[model samples]
Target: MRTVRFSAVAAVTAAALTAVTACTAKSDAEDGTAIQVTAADSTCETSTTTVPAGHVTLKIENKGSKATEVEIVFPDDRIVAEKENIGPGTKYRLTAEVKAGEYEIACRPGMKGHGVRQKLTVTGGTTVKRDPKLDKAVADYRAYVQEQADETLPRVETFAKAIKDGDLEAAKKAYAISRLGWERTEPVAESFGDIDPKVDVRADGLEPGQKWTGWHRLEKALWADKKIGAEEKTLADRLVTDLKDWQKRVGTAEITPTSMANGAKELLDEVATGKVTGEEDRYAHTDLVDFKGNVEGAQKAYELLKPVAAKNDPALAQELDRQFAALDKLLDTYRSDKTSYDFVSYDKVGKDDRKELSDAVNALAEPLSKLAAAVVK
Candidate 1:
């Protein structure tokens, strides 16, 4: 789960109107026209505000002084697609399948705040034809997300129960187990906009006036404070309640073939930015557990989309398979048990070990980023 921050609605609306002229354009999946997005420190500018419903591509350049994030979002701020941590002066191509609707192209400089915005209108157009297998892949991915959510709740209950009972050791043991499903399916949960912050926000990620809740908050109390107080117990129950909301909402999350592919890459990004850095499970040092979960989730998506990706670009598919296997084997080396999540603690890992892991993730991420385009072909 990642921290979520939003800009004031009025400010976003005014900026969006000023950034782009409201104009209609005729374009479709076949047109292959790309929207040019330029992101700077205080502004987000889009070449056009309208496109026909189908596959949409953004050619993004970050002219910002700091790293930025770009997203295509609903008016209510649910993300359709996003590419995070675009370093200064870097370029990225983000592709997403969007239906006819009103949307916004948001650019968050420094990867914080609501960001600069431009209004986007997706006009009704002929649906892009897809292979029947792609549809099945989406169906299966939805089921996989649901199953993860369903499994997560009971484990979370056990964790919360341990907390309520004041059983610190039991709570600590259950913590990583409870988070496995969440780590696996975070991208789907993040599509909902509100759930992640409530259940996953870290103390540093919280905006002023935002109450600190979620797993990380409890994590600090358990491992850092080394005690579970009354406040921690109350937060434990809140965690279960928030996750229940996530479980109920999973079925309704927007899922597409490209989203699955993109989400797989996002999971790797999570590993690079959070898990590998030892920031995600800082207190407990269970970074490897989350790291493994993220990799498994990415693999599941790639495997589901492999048939189409392989057909479109056989070489890319072959490279992805090799890299994934290599990374998995490398991760296994750190696990003494080999059959469970019993990997070395992040703090115990040496600089060389961490570098090896980081290298493996980068090797896979480069090819995985191309999967979206292959599947959409």
Candidate 2:
């Protein structure tokens, strides 16, 4: 294709053409002009919607294997008309008219994040631009949702399966993996911070034997530990529902009335899931013990690895730095409040209180060194 040189009006026209891809797509030949926009590096034209609140229908054709999301955003990149096309070569129709205002067209793959952004100018329609902050909330929600679906749910299922199989070793491994996955998603749980994990997730009636530690799995007889009775099933079912809801609602669609509603629904999902989740205090009192152990192990390993870190190796210092940093951050995130601010009382000490601080900081960084050594070839 030739690089089309443009005069002033032509330049504006190309920019406008780029903008035309902004809305949901539909043919309005009988009623008005229909501009077809194929997305980036793909022959799929985006969906376009007519404006000024008329009877309009925007048809989006996503000619790809993966699901695709298209949006008509405001000049400020707020989605105006949005549609999601699922699976390979799926077509979605958005039967809504764009109100008057300035907007742009943006499309992205379903699993992937946002995609190509094109500016769209809807003539004679009300353009309801979005508040930029809403976009951030949607993004944050999406990240959390991905973590829940990709990591949290799978981990939960693994743990449940392990317990169901009555395999102690598998249960143990699942427990640890579940912790990592849960930690990754725990921040979003803050939004639904009221869940009392003990009551919500207890394995009362389930027989001992193996390690049925997580909720939703039974050991031996039918919930013999029916401390919660049938209500437990209700909670478990709610958790599963919440997980699905989170998977669906946490998309980066426009903050339109519908998207706004979806945002609320996502929050609700968090609540439902939170209600059923047995919250293991990541920084539980026992975890402090583990953290301390990991730190010391890291430090000792690093100290040992230092000998292996050839003196001539330029990267040695940096690797040491990186390992220490990760350990420190982990410690900082989970360290007890007592140790975070106060100094450990030493027996024989001088005015060198700095030594105590060094001890504190080192305590956190010790784990990384040990971890590094264990993995070192």
Off by over 4 Å in 1: 10-31
lDDT of 2 by residue, 1-377 (tens): 00011122222223323323345555564423344544432323544543454323344566555655565545533334444433456554333335655655555544223355554556664433433443444455455446544665676566555545555446444434343333333323322312213112233322223233223332211223323334433433454445444445334333232232222222222222221121222112122222333233333323433433334233654555565565455445433463542212222223353243345444433332222212121
| Model 2: residues with Cα > 4 Å off, grouped in runs | 1-56, 125-377
Estimate every model's Cα lDDT from 0 to 1: 0.89, 0.38
Ten residues in a row with the worst lDDT in model 1? 22-31
Give the lowest summed-lDDT range of ten residues in model 2. 1-10
Per-residue lDDT tens digits of candidate 1, residues 202-268? Answer: 7778866789998999999999999999999999999999999999999999999989999999999
Q: TM-score winner among the candidates?
A: 1
